[model samples]
Target chain A: MSQQKILSRPSVGAFMSKYGIVVIFVGLCIILSIMSPVFLSMRNITNVIRQVSIIGIVSMGVTFAIITTGIDLSSGSMIALISVVVATLSQNAMNPDQPVSIVMPIAIAVAISLLLGIILGAVNGTLTAFGKIPPFIATLGMMTVARGAAALYTRGRPVGDLKETFTFIGTGSIFGIPLPIWIYLAMGILAHILLSKTKFGRHVFAIGGNEQAARICGINVEKTLVKVYAFAGFLTAVSAILLTARTSAGNPTYGLSYELDAIASTVIGGTSLSGGVGSIPFCVIGALIIGVLNNGMDLMGVNAYWQQIAKGVIIVAAVLIDARKQKRG
Target chain B: MKKTVLVLVAMCMLILPTAIFANGQQEDGKILIGAAMSSFSDKGQTYLQDGVREFDAENDDVEVLMTDAKDDAAVQLNQIETLLVKGVDAIFIVPVDISALKPVFKKCKEDGVKVVIGNRMPAEELWGEFDVYTGSESIQAGILQAEWVAEAMQPEGGKVGIIMGPLGHEAARMRTEGNKQIFAKYDNIEIVMDAEGKWDRAKGMQIAENWIQSGANLDAVLCNNDEMAIGALLAAEGANLADDAIIIAGVDATPDALEYLGAGLDVTVFQNMNAQGYNGAIAAYKLAKGESVEKWDWIPFETVTPENMSEYK
Candidate 1:
C-alpha cells in the first residue's frame, strides 16, 4: 500500500479521509452563522471557544486514554472530588483574620488537587495494568468511589464564599483572552508534543495497537499505561480547577456524567475507540462542534429535546463517516 | 446440581426475610406507614427526610418505613412493591416521575392501601387516584421570581433572559408558565432568550455567558432554581457586570442561594420545604387514622429580596 501511494498521487478518498472532519467543522460554523446572526460575531466566537474549553481540556486527556486503548470514567468524579477540596481550602483562606497570603491557599489547593488526581489515576492504572481488570471496570469503580468521597466530604452541600483570588483563576483574562482558553491551548500543545514527538508517546501508541508485540519489542507496556492514565488524571484536575473557578463554588453534584461528554468529544473528534488513532487538534475541533451545536440551537430557540436529538444524530453521523473512511483505507 | 440448588434455596430463605424485615417492624397497636423517596442526593430530598424524622420523633403510635429510590423510577416502583409485600397500612411516595408511577399507584389502590403523593403531583387524571397531594405550588415560585424581576426592571422594562431547568419537567414547566403570565402583564418587559439550563449550574453559566457575549442586551435573568441563578451570578460577575447591572431571581432559596443573595444576588423565592414535608406527613397520618384531612394542601412561597435578606438569614 505504501509503495502504491509513493508511486501515484493521493486519491480523492484518501484526501477526504484526511480533511473531512475539518470540512464538517467549518461547514457547521458557516451554516450556524447563516441561521443565527449572533453565531458569527467575534464575541460569540470567543464565547463558543470558552464554552468548549473545559470539555476540550478533559477530552485531550481522554484522547490519550483512548489512544492507549483505555477508558477513564473517573474524570467526572475526579473533578467533583478535586473541586470540593479546592473550594474548601480556598474558602477557608478567604476567612477573616487569616495571616497567610492568598497565594498560599490557592497554591495549596491546586497542589492537593493535582496530587489527588494523580493518586486516583494511579489507582485506575494499577487495577487495569497489573490487576488485569478491564479499563472500563477499573475506571467505573473509581468513578463511584471518587463521587462518594466528594459527597461525603461536604455532605451534599455546595461550598461557596470563595476568595476573590481563587475566583480570578476561572474568571480572569490574560491579555484580553479568558484564562481557560489559554490553559486549554497550552494543554493541547503539550499533549500534541507528548503524543507525536516523545518516545513515551510512541510507547503508548505501540502498547495500544498491539500490547503483545509491544511487550515483545521490549517496551514497558505497564509503565506506559500507568503514565498515560496519570496524564489524564492531571488534566482532569486542571479542568476541575477551572470549572470550580467559573462557578465560583464547588458542589458534589457538579460534573455529573461529564466523563460521557469527554468521551463523546473524543469519539466525535475521529478518535477510534478501539485504540491508537486520534489527534489532539481533531479532538478540540470535535469539542468545538458540540459547543457550536449547543450554542446555535439555544440562539435559534430550538427545543431542548430536539437539541439533544440533533446532538445524538451528529455523533452517530461522525462515527459513521469515520467508519466509511476506515473502509476506504 | 441438586446439592447446589438445596444450598441456594437455604441461603435465600435466610437472606430474603431479613432484608425485607429491616424496616418492616410492625406493632399490633401501631400503624406502619411506608415512605419511598425519589432520591437523597439533593438538598430538597434531605430536607424532606429531616421533616420525616422530625415527625417520627414526635409521633408515638405511627412508624414510618422509608426507602431511598436513588432517583430511578423503576427503583421507586420496586421499593413500593417491597413495602407492599411487608403489608404496611399506608404508603407515601415522592415519585421520580409522576407519570411513570401511575401503574404502581394503581396497584397500591387495588390492594386497598391508602396512597399519599408528596412533593410532585401526578397528572390531573390520577389526581382522584391518590388520597392526597401536598407540596408547594410550583407556579407560585415562578410568579414570585418574575414579580421580583418586574419590580427590578421597573417602568423602563428591559430585555430579559430566562434560564429554565429541564424542559417538560412539571416544576420547570409550571415555573416558566408563571413567569410568562407575569411578563405578559407588562408590555415593557421583553424575553429575549429562554434557554434550558438542564437544571445544572455549569449549563446555566454557559448559557448566560453566551448571552452576555452575544450582546443580547439582557437586563435580567430569571432562573427556575437556585443552582442556575448562582450560575448566572458567576457569569455576570465574570463579565464585570455591576452588582446592580442586572436583576437575577431564582427559586428554592437554597443555602447557597441565600449566600449568593448575601453576597449581592438580586432576589430568591423560598419554597418552605420544611413546611411542605412536615405538613404533608401529618396530613397523611391524619388520613391513615380516618380523620378528615385536606385533599389538596398548598404551601406558599415567600419572596426573599435584598431588602428583607436579614429576615431570611
Candidate 2:
C-alpha cells in the first residue's frame, strides 16, 4: 500500500508540474467566455492568436535565453531598430518606372535585419560570456546602444509609404490565417526542436542547470552562451520584420518596453528566471494568456486602469505559483 | 607632486570653461533668447522648431539658442539652468511637465529674464509669473473634435467609443473631460467605452479590435491623438467594416492623420503647433525689447475634414 501511494505521489506531482499553467489558462478562457458571449467565437479566437504572435515569437526567443540562465533587455530595442531599417529599404525610394519587383527588396531587407540582430546578439554574448559582465547589465547596455542606433539611423523620423508587397506579408492571409501567425508557429516549432533535439540545446540546459557543473562535464560554456544569444537575435529579427510589415511604417519609437512583455510571457509560461526549466510551447501559451486577458477585458468593457491592475495581479500570481512548484520539486 | 598637477589640471578645465562662457555671453551685443523644447522627435515638435528657426533667420538682431529636453523634465531643468547661466535676455519654453519647472521659472523671474510659455501651461497660475502663454487649451481641442463628430452624426445621437492617450497626463485628462462634457449635452449620444491607448498605434488598434469583437453598437471612435485615430481606422478596416459604419476623429492634424482624413476618415483637429512656436518667439522678442507683453496668446484649433484637408496640408 505504501509503495502504491509513493508511486501515485510522483505521478501527481509530475502532472501538476507540467499542467499547472495550462489549467490556469483554460480557467481564464472559461471565465472570460462565460462573461462575454463573443469571446469564444472563431473570429475572436483568431484575433487573440494573431495579436499574440508578435510577442509570442519574442517569448520563444526569451525562453531560450532564460533556460540558459540569462536575460535579454535588448530584444525590444533591437526589434525597433530592425523595423526602421527594413521599412526604409522596402520603400521604393527610387520610384522605378515600372515599379521594381517586391521580392528583391523584401529579401534584402530580411537579410540585412537578420545580420544586424545576429551581430548585436553576438556583441551581447561576447560582453557577458567573455568580458565578465552580467547578462542583465550587458543586455541593458545593448538596449540603450541599439535604441540610439535606431534613432540615429533614421534621424528620428518615421519611414512610411511602403510598397504593396511589403505590406502583404503583414496583412495577407494564407488559407484564412494571417501570415504573422504562421511565422510565429513556425518559429515556435523551430525553437522547440532546438531546445529538445539539438546538442546546442542540451548544452544550454546544462549550462543553465549549473554552470560550474556544466564546465566540469566538458561543455563549452562560452560557445553555448554565444549560440543562445544568437538564437535569440534570430527570433528578435523575425518579430521586427513582421511588426514592420504590419505597421507598414517604421518609427524609432516602435517596440518600446517590449522586452518586459517578452519576459512576462516567459515567466508566466512556467519558466523559472533561474533557468533550465522552460519550453517553447509553454511560452506560447503564456503569450496567449496575456493576449486573451487584454482582449477579454476589452470585450467586457472593463476600465483600462482596472485592466492594468488585473494584469499586474495575474503576473504576480503566476510567478508565485511557479516559485512554489520549484520549491516543491 | 603628480597628484597635485592632476588636480590643478581638472580645476583649470572647469574654471576656464566658465570664464570663457561668461565672456562669450557679455561680449555679444545681440539679444540672446533661449528656447527649451520638450522634444524634437515627433513631427509636431519638428514643425515647432521650423517656426523657431524661421524667426531666428528673419531677425538679425536676435540670436536664439535651442535645446531639446527629449521628454525629460529634469533635462529641461538643466537646460534652463544652462540658459540662465548664459545670461539670456529672454526664454521660451515648451515644457514637458509644468509642475517640475516651477523652481526654474521662479529663478528666471529672480534673474529678471522674460519667460514665454508655449504648448504646455505651467501647473501654477501664470498671471504675474509669465509674460505670455502661447498654446491652445487641451480641453478646447477635445471640444472641437466632438463638435465635428456631433455634426457628422446629425439629428440622431449615436454610441461613441473613446481612445484616450496616457492616463493622468494633463492633455489626456482635459481632452477626455472635454469629450465627456460635449457628449453629455446630446441626449441621443452615449459613451459606450473609454479605454487608454497610451498614445500608441498598436495599443490603440488592440483596444479597438476588442471593442469591435465585443459587437458593441458603436457609431464612432474618438481618439485623443492622431496615432490612436489611425489605429482605430486600421482595426475597422481589418474587420471589413464599412467606411461610414463608424465615424473616427482625432486631435493633432499630423501628416499621417491628414492622409487618413484625405483617405476618408471623418475628422481631425489642427492645433497649430508651428503657430504657437512662431508667436512664442515673437512674444519673447517683444518682451526682450521691454514692450508690454500680453497675458495670453490663444491658438485656435480648427477642424480638418476631406473638404478642408488641402488647406491644412
Candidate 3:
C-alpha cells in the first residue's frame, strides 16, 4: 500500500516541466522590470509583442509539426521565397519620381503566395511520407532549394517600392494593438482548436506516440504527415507576407536562419523534441520569453557580443532546468 | 566498397551548382572574359554584374562569362579553375575572400591570363597580383558620411548613436572605425550609444526603438547601411520625434533611401556600383588586349541629399 502511494505521487520534474515556460516568462519580466525603467511600459510591451509576432506565429506552426514527431527546417527559406514572389506581384511597376506609388491589388498576390506556400509544404510532406525520407533531410533539402529559388527569382536584388495599401497590413494597428499581434493571437486560437478539438490533432499525437500502433489503429499516417508539413509551410508564408510588408520591401536575403528561432521557441516552450506532448499557450510563452530577453538586453545597453552569449546561456539554462526533473522521473 | 564510392560521387555531382556550366561555353571567334563574382545574390554585386554585362554588350569582340561564387570561397576557386581550363583571355574577379584568392592569382599568372579584381579592397601586400582595382575605399565611405554628420550636429555637437552591421563584417568594422575617428575630432560631439543591427530592417527597427526609449540625449544617428537608417527613421517617427529633431545618415544610398532624402534622412553616401562594374570590366578587357591600365583606378563615394538626389537618379 505504501509503495502504491509512492508511485501515485507526482515527481518535481513533472510539475516543473509542465509549468516551467510560464515560470521563466514571469521571472524574466520581474528581472527586466527591475533592470530597465521602460521594460514594463505599455508602448514598450506592445513593441516587444509586435516584434515577436512574426517569429511567434512561425513557432506555433512548428509546435504542431513537432507534436507529430516531425520538423520544419524550410520555414525560413519559404519565408524568403514567398516574400519575394508576393512582393513582385504586389509591387508597383518600375516608376521613377516618388517611389512609394500606387500598386496592383494585392488580394490575388496574397492568395498566390498562400497557395505557393501550401504547395511547397505539401511537397515536403509528400517527400517525407511517400518517398520515405526523414523529416530532417527532406526539409533540409527544401530549405536549400527554396533559398536558391528566391535568389534566382530576383537575381539577388531587393524588390522595393511596394504598394502602400499592402504595407498597412503589416504596420497598421487596430485598437492600439498592431496587426501582426492580432494575426498572432488569431492563429494561436485557431491552432489550439485544431490541436485539441479536431480528429486530425488526435491522430498527430497518436502518430508521435507510436507510428506503428497509429497505423495499425487505422490512422492515415502518410496523409496526416503531409498535412502537418503543409500547415507549417502555410504559417511560414503568413510570416513572410507580414515581414515583407513591414520592411516595405522584399529581398532574397530576408528570413535568414528564422527557422532556428522558431524551433528554439518551440523547444523552450516545453514541446518535447521526442514528440507527443505540447501546447499552443506554452509556445506563445516561449516566444515571449525570447522577445523580453532581447528587448531587456538592448534597453540595458548590454554589449552585443555578450548579448549573444547571454541568449545562448539563457536558452540552454531554461531547457536544462526544465528537463532535469523529467530525466529523474 | 566500389559501389559505395560510386554512389557518393554521384551524390556529390548532383549537389554541385549548374551555374559553372550555365555560361561557360567559349565561342570560336570571341575574346571570352570570365567574371567570377563573389555572390550574385547580393544586391550590390548584382549591379556590378550588370556593369560587366553592359561593357560586354558594348563590345562585339568581347564576351563576359560570369559565375556566381554563392559566397563560398572554395566554390569560387573551383569556378576559376574551370574558367582557366576553358582558356579565357582575362578574368574580372570579385573575390569571395580576398586572402583566399592567392591560388587563383597564382594560377592566372601561370596561364598568362590578365586578372582584374573588383569591389573588395585587398591589403597593400596583395596589390601587385591584380592589374587594376575598381571600387571606392571602404574607409572613405564612413569618413565622407561622418563628415556630413559632424557638420549637421553643429557647434554644440550634441549626443550621437550608431547602428552597425554584423560585428565581424569587414565593411562594418571599417565604416565604424571611420565614424568613431571623425566624431572624436569634435569636443562637443559625444557618442552616447551603439548597437549591431545585423543588416536587417526589422532588427534595426527593434534596436532603434530600444535606443530611443532609453531617454538618451540623442542628437544624431549613423547607420552603416541605408536599411538600418530607414529602420531608425521609422522608429523615431513612431516615437513622435520630429523630422529635424535628430540627424540620420547612412552609407549605401539605396533607392528607398533616396526617397526620404531631406524629408527625414539628412544625407547618405552612394558607393557607385555602376562605376565599379563598368570600370572593372573595361579594365579587364584592356588588360586582355595587352594595354596598360592604372593599378588603383578609384570610383569615389558621393554624398546624396535632397539637393543632389536628382543628379544620382
Candidate 4:
C-alpha cells in the first residue's frame, strides 16, 4: 500500500491539478440533479448557462488578470458606467415625433462601448504596471470612480427606451440559443486562443510565475500587463452592453457586487489568488458551478439566507482545494 | 507610481466636485435647505430630488443644497452633519437605512435643524423622532399588488413564487409582509417558494427561470419591485409560458416595467415619488416657517394595470 502510494502520487497530483475543478463541477451537477430532477433538463441547463454567461465572460478576462498575478475590481462599476453610457447612445425616442436624447446609431454605440472598455482597462493596467500601484488598490479606486461617474452622467435615473435591435443583443435568441449564451461561447473561445496560442499569453504566465525571472528573460512585463488589463476591461464593456440590453434599461445601480462574483469565478476555477496558473474553460466551469447552486437552491425552496451561506462555503472550499493542491505540489 | 497616483486623483477630481453640495456658507437673507439624498443613482430618488430641485429653481428666497449618499447609511450620517455645519435651517432627508434616524435625529435636534422624512420610511420605533413623515405605505403597496394578483387568479387559485429585494431591507420586509397578509386570504393561491433577488434584474430573471424549469405549475410570480417583475416576464416568455398562464406583479411603476404592463406584467403600484419629494420639501419649508406641520403626509399608492398604464406613462 505504501509503495503504491509512492508510485501513484506524481501522476495523480498532475492529473488532479489539471482536471480537479472539472471533476468538482460534474460532481456538483450530479448532486444537484439528484436533489431536483429538473436540474439537468434541457430547459434548466439552458437557463443555468444563460444565467452564468455574464459572469462567465467577465471571469475569462479575470482569469487572464489572475494568471498575470493581478486583479480587476473595476469590472462591476465599469459595467454600470458602460451600460448607462451605451444605453444613452442607443436610446430610442419614446415616440417618433418626440425629440430623442442624443441617440446615436446602435453600431457606433457598441463600438464606443468596446473602446471605453479598452481605455478603462488600460488605465487599470497602467496603474499596476507603470504606476507600481497594486492592482487591487488601482482597480478599487477605478471601481468607485466609475460608479460615481455613472451616477453623475444620468443623475441617478435609468437610461431606457432603447432601440429594439440593441435590446436583441440581450433578449433575442438564435437557433434555440440565447444571444448571451452565444456571446459567452464566442468570447470564451476568443479568450482561450488569446491566452494559450500567443506570445502575449506566455508573457502573462511568466510574469505571474516569477516576475524577476520574466524580466531577466526579457519579457516586456509592463506592456503585457497593460494589455492584459485592457483585455479584461474590454470584456467588461461587452458584458455591460449585454446586461443593459437584456434589462431594457441602464440604471447606475447596475452591476453592483458583480466584481466579487467575477473574482470568485476566477478563483474557484482553480486560479490562484496568489497569482499564476488559470484557464478559461475552468473559469466557465466555475461560473456554472455557481449558477447551478443558485438554481438548485431556489428550486429546492431553500431560504435565501441559506443560499448565501452555501455559496460562501463553496467558494471557500474551492480556494481550499487550490491551496491544498499547491501545498502538495 | 506618482504619475499613476496623479492620474487617479485627476479621475477623482471629475467626480468629487459633485459631492461638495455645500460650501458651509449661508447666502445673505436666503433660507438654506440641505437635502440629504439616499441615492442620486436610483430613478425614483432622482425623481424625488427633481421635485425638490424644481422647488429650488422656482424660489429665489430658498436655496436647496443636495448631497447624494450613494446609498450608504454611514455616508448619509456624515452628510447630515455637513448639512448642519452649513447652517441650513431645515434638512430634507431620504434615509439610506434606519441607521440615520437615532443619530441624525439626535444631532439635528441638538442643533435645532428641522428633519422631515420622505420617500422610504424608517423603522417603526424610530418613527417618533422625525418631525414629519411623508410617504406611501410599503405595506399598502404589497396589499394593492397582492390583492390585484390574487383577484386575477380568480376561481382557480394557483401556485405562486415570490422574488424579493435584499433580505432585511425595510421595503423588502414590509412589502413582503403586506403581500403575505393578502395572500393568506386566498384558499387556492399558495406560495410555493420565495427568494431574495437582491433588487437585481438578472437575479430576478434567473430565479423566475429556475421556478419555471422546476415545473411547478406556477400561477403567479410576485416581485418586490418592477425590475424583478420585468425580469420575470422575460423569463416567462423565454420559457414559452402562455401569456395568460401566470400573474406577475411588481411594485413601483418604473418606465421599463410599465412598458411591459399589458404585454407581460399584470400590475404595478405607483408610489407617486415626485409628489412625495415635492410634498416632503413643502413640509420642511413649513417647519422652517414656524408653522404647525402635520405629523404624517400619507401619499396613496396607486395600482397601475394595463387599463390604467397609459395614465402612468
Candidate 5:
C-alpha cells in the first residue's frame, strides 16, 4: 500500500495542480452520493447530466472567450434569440397540416443558428475591435438588444409545435445516454482539440496574457478577439437550439439569468476571471459540480431559497480557492 | 444625409398617428375606460382585452382604450397619466404594483374619474375609495389545492413539497399562506421543502429534480402555478419516477396543465381568469354608466383532475 501511494503521489500532485477543479468536483460528487442514496442511482445521474448539458456547452464557449481576456454576457440572450428563429423556421418547415419530415426542420434550425451566430458575433467583434467599446459594455448592450429582439420576434408569445426529431436532440438519448450529454461531450472534445492544437488558440492565450506584447510579436490582436467572441456566439446559438428542443417551446424569456450560470461555471472551473487561463474539461467539471449540487440539494429536500444560498456559497468558495492559487503563483 | 433624412421621416411617421388620435377624442357624453395592463402577452391581457371587446360589442357608448404597462410600475404610472389627460370617464387598472399605483388611483379620485381595480387588490383604504374591486382569492387557490391533497392522501398524509414563485409577491405569499393553513390541520402532512421557482419552469424542474435526487421521498408537490407543476412532472419523468405517481397539483388551469391532466400526470386549479376579465369589464362599464357597482366581487374557481379532465377537453 505504501509503494502504491508512492507511485501515485506524483500524478496525484500533478492532477491537483493542473486539474484541481475536476478533483474538487469529483469530491463533491462523492460527498453528495454518500449523503443521498438517490444521487448514486442511474436515473438521477442521467437526469443531472441532461440538466447540465446546455449550460456545459455554453460554458465551453465561455472558456474560449475568457482565455482571450474577454467576456460574452450576450450568450444567454443570443440563445433566446436563436431559439426563436429556430422555432419559427422549424414550425414553418413542418406545418402541422402539411407536415414534412423532421429532418428539414432540424437542418433549418442548425443552419439558422449558425448564421445568426456568425452575424451576431461579427457585430460584437466589430464593436470591440474597431468601435473600441469595452468587452463588458459591448456584450451588455448586445445582451439587451438580443433579448429585446427575441421578445419582439415572438411578440411575447412562445413558439411551439416542433417536430419530434428536433425535440429528440433535447429529449431523446441513445443507449440510455441523453443526446444533450453527448452533444456536450462532442463540443468538449472539439474545444479541447482547438485549444491544444490550433494556432488561433495560441493567439487567444497570447493576446489574453498581454495584448500589446502579442501585437508586438506580430499577432493580430483585434482579429483574435473578434474570433473569440464570434466563437462564443456560435456556441450560444447551439445552446439555444438544445434548450428549445428540450423544452419543446421557445419563449422570449427562456434564457433569463443563464449568463450568470455560464460565468459562474467558467469561474468555478478555475478559469481566471482576469483571463489567460482555462480548460474545457475543467469547465465541464465545474458545470457538473453545479448540476450535482442542484440534484443533491433537491434530493435532500433543501428549500429553494436555501438552495440559492448554497449555490452562492459554493461559487464564493471556488473563487476564493482560485484567488489563493493566484496569490501563491 | 439621405439616410438621416429618411430616419427622421420614419420616426415622424410612427409618432404622428397616435398624437393625432389623442387630440381628436374628447367628448363629454363618450364613456372612456382606460385599462392599465400588466403586459400585452400575458393571459391577463388576453382576458382583459376579450372582456373589453365584449363590452364594446354590447354597448355603443363605451369606448375602451388600453395601454400595456409591460409589467413596469413606472410605465404603468405614465399610462395612467396619459389616460387621465385623455379625460377618461372611468379607469380600470390591473396595477403593476399595488402600492405604487395607489397614487395614480388617488389622483384619479381627485380628478373625479371612477376607478375600477381589476385582478389585483389595492390597500384597504383604496378598496373603499375605488368603485369596484374584482379578483380571484389567491389564498383560496392555495387552500383548495391543499384540501385536494389532504383528501387524496386521506387519514395518513404524506410528505409534500411546494414550488413557489418569487417570495413576497402577493399571489405567491397568499397561496403559500393558504397551503400552510390547510396543511397545518393534517398532522400527517409534512412539508419537506418550499423553493422559489421565480415563476420559471426550468428552475422549478431543477429544484424538483434536486429534491427527488436527495431522497426526500416526497409524496406530492404543490406548485404556485401550472408552469412549475409541469416542470415538476418533467423532472419526475426524467428521473424515471413518472410511474411512481407522485401527486402534483398546481394553480392556473393553463392549457398545458389541462393537457397534463388529460394525460393523467397532474391536477390543477382553474382560476377562471376569463371570468375575472369579463366581470372586471362589466364592473368598469357599470361604474361608467353612473350605476352603483359592488365594492368587491369574487370569480368562481374549479379543481381539475384526470377524472373530470374530459369535461375540459
Candidate 6:
C-alpha cells in the first residue's frame, strides 16, 4: 500500500505542476466563450491562432534562453531592424525584375536575418559573460540601439513595394492553416526536440539550475549562454520576416511591445521569471491565452483603452497565481 | 584651452551684433513677427518653415523671428516670452498642446500682440482670445472618406473596419467621430473592429491581417491617415483579399497615397498641406501688419479616386 501511495504521489505532483497552466487556459477559454458568443466560433479561434503565431514563435526561442537563466529585452527591436532590411531588399528585387526569382529574395532575407541574430546575440553574450554587465542592462541597451538603428534606416517612413510572393509567409495557408501558424508550430517542434532530447538542452537546464555547479561539471558556461542568446536572435528574425510578409511593408515601428508579450507568455506558462524551468507547449499555450483575450475583447466591443487595462490585470493575475505556486513549493 | 577661448570669443562677437540688431530693429518701423514652431522634424517643421519662408518672401515690411521648441509646450512658452520681451508686433504659434498654450495666448492678449494660431485649435475661451485660428477640419476629412465609401458600396452597405491613429490625438479623435456620424446614417453598414494603429504602417497591417483572419467579412477599411490606409492595403494584398477589391480609403494626400491612387489601389481625401503652410504665413503676416482678420478660417479638401487620380498625377 505504501509503495502504491508513493508511486501515486509522484504522479499527483507531476500532474499538479505541469497541467496547471493548461487547466487555467482552458478555464479562461470557457469563461470568455460564455461571456461572448463570438469567442466560440471557429473563425475567431483561427484568428486568435494567427494573432498569437508571431509572439509564440519568438517566445519559443525565449523559452530556451530563459531555461538558462538569461533574458533578451532586445528581441522586439531586433525584429524591427531585421524586418526593414528584409523588406527593403525584397522591394528592390521586385522592382528590378531580375533573373533571380522570389525564392532568391526569401533565401537572402533568411541569411541576413540569421547573421543579424548571431551578431546581436554575440554582443549581448559578450557583455554579460566577459564585461560582467547584468543581462537586463546589456539587453536593454541593445533594445534601444537596435530600435534607433531601425528608425535611422527608414528615416521615419515605411518601406514599401514588396513582391506578392514575399508576402505569402504572413498571409498564405496550407490545408487551411495560416503559414505563420505553421512556421510557429514547426519551430516549436524543433525547440521541443532540442530541449527534451539533446545534451545541449541538459546543459542549459543544468546551468540555469546552478551556474557554479554546472561550470564545475565542464559545461563551458560562457559558450552555452552565447548560443542561447544567438538562438533567441534567430527566432526574433523569423518573427520579423513573418511580420514583414504580413504587412507587405517594412516599418521601423513593427513589433513594438512584442518583447513584453513574449516575456509575459513565458512566465505565465510556468517558466519561472527567476529561470530554471519552462516548456515549449506551455509557452505556446500562454501565447494563445493572450491571443484569445485580445480577440474576445475585440468581439465583445470593449474599448481600446479598457482592453489594455484588462490585459494588464490578466497578466498580473496569472503571475500572482504562479507566485503562489512557487511559495507553496 | 587658449584656442577654445579664442573660438568662444569669436562666436560671441558674431552673435552679439545679430542679437543687438534684432532688439534694435524691433520698434514700430520694423514689424517684429514672432513665430513659435513646435518641432523641427516631419510635418510640423515642414509647415512652420514653409510658412515663415513664404511670409518673408511675400512681405518685405515684416521681419519674422522664429524659434523651434522641439515639440515642448514649456519651450514654446519660453520662446513666446522671449519674443514678447523683444517687443514683437505679433506672434504666430503652432502649439504643441492646445490646452497648455492658453496662458501664452492670454499673455499675448494682455501685451496687445496679435496671436495667430496655425493648425491646432485651442479651447473656446483661448480661441475667442486669439486674433485668428486657421487649420483643416480633421473631422471633415474623415466624413468625406466615409461618404466616398458609402457611395461606392451603394445599396449593399458593406461591412467596414477602421485602423486609426492614437486615441486622444485631435486628428484621430475627430476623424473617428466624423466617421461615426456618417456610419449612423447607414442602416446596413456595420463596423466590425476599430483598432489603433498608432499612425504606424506595420501596426495597421497587423491589425488588418488579424481582422481578415478572424473571418469578420469586412468589405472596406477606412484609416485616419494615408500611412495606415496603405498598411491596410498591404495586409489585404498579402492575405489575397485584394481580389475582392475591398475598398480602402484614407485622409492625407501624401505623395505615396497619390501614387497608390494612380495605381488604382486606394482612395484618399486630399487636403492642401502646402496651402496650410502658405495661408498660415499670410495670416501671420497680416496679423503682424496690424490688419484685421477673422477668428476662424477653414481649408477645403477634395476626395480623390482612381477616376480623378490622373488629375492629381
Taken over the whole model, the C-alpha lDDT of each candidate is 0.83, 0.84, 0.85, 0.86, 0.78, 0.76
Query: Which of the predicted structures, 2 or 3, would earn the higher TM-score when compared with the native?
Result: 2
- Candidate 2 residue-wise lDDT, A195-250, digit = tens: 98999889989998999999999999998888888889889988888878776677
lDDT of 6 at B37: 76
- For each candidate, what's the DockQ? 0.48, 0.60, 0.55, 0.62, 0.43, 0.26
Model 4 lDDT per residue over A1-329, tens place? 97677567777676766777787788888888898988888878877888888888888998999998899999999999998888888887633422234677889989998999999999999999999999999999999999999888876667778899999999888998889999999999999999889999888999999999999999999999999999999899989988988888887888999999998888888887777788888899888888888889987877788989998998788668766765664
Q: What docking grade applies to model 5?
A: acceptable
lDDT per residue (tens digit) for residues B180-299 in model 5 = 999999989999888888776677777777777766778999999877787788778766785446888888877656766745346788776666767777787787678997788987
Model 4 chain B lDDT-worst window of ten: B18-27
lDDT assessment of candidate 5 = 0.78
Residue B310, model 1: lDDT of 76
User: Which pairs clash in model 1?
Assistant: none
lDDT score of model 3? 0.85
In order of listing, the candidates' clash counts read 0, 0, 0, 1, 8, 0
Output the lDDT of residue B66, model 2. Answer: 98
Once fitted onto the true fold, the runs of candidate 2 whose alpha carbons sit more than 4 angstroms away are A1-13, A92-104, A325-329, B1-26, B124-128
TM-score, predicted candidate 6 vs. hidden true structure: 0.78
In candidate 4 chain A, where is summed lDDT lowest over 10 consecutive residues? Answer: A93-102
Per-residue lDDT tens digits for candidate 3, residues B111-187, read: 78888989888888998898889888888888999999999888778988888888877788888888999999999
Residue-pair clash count for candidate 1: 0
Calculate the i-RMS of every candidate, to one decimal place: 2.0, 1.5, 1.4, 1.3, 2.4, 3.7
- Chain B TM-score, model 2, reads 0.92
For model 6, the DockQ equals 0.26
Identify the candidate with maximal TM-score: 2
Which is the leading candidate under lDDT? 4
Highest DockQ among the candidates is held by which one?
4
Better structure of 1 and 5 per DockQ: 1
lDDT of 5 by residue, A1-329 (tens): 97587557776454556656666777788988788777888878788888898888888888888877888788888888888788776663444422121335468668877789868977888799888998888989999899778867766656666777787878888998999888888888988888878999888889888888999999998887888888888878888888888776676767877888898898888888788888888888888888888778777777667888998998788667656654543
Per-residue lDDT, model 5, residue B269, is 84
